[model samples]
Target: MKEIYLVGGAVRDKLLGYPYSEKDWVVVGATPEEMESEGYRPVGKDFPVFLHPETGEEYALARTERKTAPGYSGFVFHTSPDITLKEDLLRRDLTINAIAEDCQGNIFDPYGGRQDLQSRILRHVSDAFSEDPVRVLRVARFAARYHHLGFTLAEETRQLMSSMVQEGEVSHLVPERVWKETERALREPSPHIFVEVLRQCGALAVIMPELDNLFGVPQPKQHHPEVDCGLHCLMALEQARQLSEDSEVLFAALVHDLGKAETPTEELPRHIGHESRSLPLIETLCDRLGVPKKHRELALSVARDHTNCHRAMELRPTTLMQLMQRLDGFRRPQHLEQFLLACEADAKGRTGLEQHPYPQREYVLQALVACNRIQARDVMEEGITGKAIGEALTRKRVSALKQFKQQFTTQDKTQ
Candidate 1:
């Protein structure tokens, strides 16, 4: 008497008329031997999860879990053939994700998932939600994903998340899981909402204290009408959503001003050297969270040089050349684009400045073009043939940039 049901995200998204990417199934009254004999390949290490031979979709056995200790990995699963669909659904994190549908499209929601879905609420399935820490991140990510649809966290669920943070459950999350969730959130339509949700539940302090520290810190009102450093960072992230959908660029924008949180009391409204201060904090956060190399590198570049990027028109030709060389702009033009987008986001993120023009992006781009047009081959053709060739190339690049700057100034005066 085995039955398979479409479950979790597939069923939830289907009910909401939202697009979904993958389908997962829950098999009741089935054993590993039965699935294997039917050509299903066993894949689950800690539980009985098999892949459908034809569709390649995952089909996990209806199972129950009990907390064995603490944290996400502290759960022990019980997968018996007698495990009912209701019992399996009870183990899920959210009511919205616990709904299921049979092959004949029969909806079986032992929980009020359909009701919650229609109400646009994100609620926990049961008190068992407290057992796993990763659910906090998942809930925040869902908030980010569906923020435009007016989805709100249920008050009870928010309380439970806050309790989990207070109980130190979130501290047990592994670095890989944290980075994975953060990276996914960064790609969401309203990614800043993810941070807001985490901060609300007090999870941000445990998971990303560096970011949480920015909340109450002050910034100059003239430069950042938002005033609070954390608010401005989130605002920057929102602006980044308009400029680029790339997660690396968005992440760079989110963390570019982390050093402001560490400023001295004497520097209350003015973060004099916050850019340099941000460098080590960014490195520490990235290292602790096991962030990927590309994300870390981009964040570091934005944190250290975003101010310089904002002042591109004021930098001398030699300084501009040095900036491009530091960014390896000629060898990695795509990375340079990412850097500029992050800087633009930072410049326009302030309150009352969302629509402000940022000419520095074009200035830096033109400067890079001027320097790039001075080819290394042209310099090598002079028979310098050594380290002098490198020096000569630098000289030519600076000279070309200076000429371009002069032309740019002349054109500006004419306008």
Candidate 2:
């Protein structure tokens, strides 16, 4: 008799008590004809996948995959009634992800997935894991998601991933798919692990060479205790998570220092004018990944003005307003908020600074609030017309910001 089983993440999550966000099923000994007769809607283009008539949950037939080409598009799948559950499970990327649970709640873990789960280890199921370049990204993403659980990659699995990277497997992945995995990883609580693991296996060099170049680049020790640009990037990401839950801000924090890697080596440690220099690299990365506009915009603003934000207290009122105008923060206050978080992440990402307070955050935010008070309508009513109104309004906003700065200066004197 044909049977259905809950497979993949649902089974793994249930075993770990992690709460399932999605449940995927595999139908054993089932044909497309049988599935259609039961009213399951066909959905998958490359393989036999059906949506349940009632629940709409995805259920794919037990199948196996083969590598027929170079990249993610190279996969060829074979789904047949003759394929067993073990065969389907073996074709999966990781052992812990290959386990399945039946309707009767009997788990089919032929590959020692359960033991690996108990040990909090992520191990590849078979040599077939090397066939798909995307699996390396998936493994890194899983590491980002599960690092808090103490999950470590198996030594052999890491070796296999290294080999895949050496063989140019990572280079074959499409940019959009790479970004899809990367975006999800950047949103996780410990996103730094994603960057670290990919770098470990050499995938970073292929997928994100600009980021990989940051590894040995040094920063001023006083400002960046982490010293290394790559390590600082990860540190900033960790700090970004604490300041903002937005994935855009997290991504911005990660790329904020990309230009530092390009700083003329003759001027070591000090990354002079790195902020503007980061813009081209950010644009290149965004275009490559087809990153969402929201993420791209936030990252661009952070890359261009993160230093301005870091030195908020020192910027003149005119300069501060220009910075705000450049960021489009007058119309979208959240953009400034995102930029401030990225700057704060950079500030606190260093060693011995994790718990240090960032006064620049409040100072910049207050500057934004003071600038927001100047309205174009109010300026227009002052008999200012045409482009002159814009200039007049800008003057008023700068004046308001000057006053705001003075109040802070006065408060400091009193203290």
Candidate 3:
């Protein structure tokens, strides 16, 4: 058996001038036994995966076969010496991902994948695409990533996704997998494509039912020129993308105002306590999605504390310091930057409306910097224990530190 080269994504990314990351190699000529004989250690128990001894790169000796099971979870494998690289490429999710390069760098285009890539179209490998519900999410994510590349879902692929959604195949997908795709899509350069794809495929309802409520929900004309809450959210998401916010912050921004769709409103629509309402909702959703606890906390913090920005600005320095102190001494530059990004996304979301009541953005940033300095230099380094700091603040020094912060701010303003 010849070792046919079938390098997939790395080749395509190279052709597109994008950075190639995480090279995954699939070997056709080697069996599990042969791989072990060649000094490749078996890694996967359920599947045949190996690691090269020299490069430490993972290589999967996956065989090709038709599915015997109904859903993506049901697949039969055939690991024989006869499997070709062409057969393996045909099983991929999309045409753009199916094209392979050989050892000599000769590109193989058996299924017209190169043409699809050139045309920037996202067509399924075959009608069997519906077998894998995850492909539906993958298509949406690819749309988000390659929209500027002019990629459009093929008609058949769209129909297949619609059918899968209608047939309840979406429920077969694990929450973690769905959340992974959704998070990735939200972090794309433009998530509008992904949102639009979901809108078309009816997959949003299964993935994020909160967002589904946004469809056709009217917003006040004055503030939102876009009319519908869903459209407005799309616009806000686009703005968030432009700001280059982190995935967690961006996801929070997308869903921060979701409560508005559920809460009752009149002609002058209002979502009182939407930020607070969204906090628990996000927590539950993130939990279901199996988001990491730290990330969930950060996103929930952004969602919950997002509404406090305007209020925080009006408080005295001491009150602000007390609030910051309540944040449990988690002082870090990255934390502050993330907070600023969340605040900025929230403000940008409210553009075209009444002016925000918060102190100017620059002023708040300066205050944050000053507050961080005080906490890092004085409060943190005090060698006096937490109990001591707590006692000092409660009794003798609270008022003094407040006075010091005030003086510092006043001096800063003067400078």
* Candidate 1: tens digits of C-alpha lDDT, residues 1-415: 8999999999999988999999999999999999999999999998999999999999999999989987779988999999999999999999999999999999999999999999999999999999999999999999999989999999999999999999999999998999999999999999999999999999998888899999999988888888999999999999999898999999999999999899998879899999999999999999999999999999999999998998899899988888888888999998999999999999999999999999999888888888888787998888878788889999999999989999999999999
- Candidate 1, residue 169: lDDT: 92
Candidates' C-alpha lDDT: 0.94, 0.90, 0.70
Ranking by lDDT: 1, 2, 3
Q: Candidate 2's residue-wise lDDT over 134-206, tens digit each?
A: 9999999999889999999999999999999998888889999999999899887689999999999999988
Candidate 3 residue pairs in clash (backbone atoms < 3 Å): none
- Model 1 has how many clashing residue pairs? 0
* Model 1 C-alpha lDDT versus the unseen true structure: 0.94
* Model 3 lDDT per residue over 65-135, tens place: 56665555677767765677778777788877877776788887778777887788889888777888898
Better of 1 and 2 by lDDT: 1
Clashes of 2: 0
Better of 1 and 3 by TM-score: 1
Off by over 4 Å in 1: none
The TM-score of predicted model 1 comes to 0.98
TM-score of each: 0.98, 0.97, 0.84
Question: Scored by Cα lDDT, where does model 2 land?
Answer: 0.90
Kindly provide the TM-score of model 2 when superposed on the true structure, using C-alpha atoms. Answer: 0.97
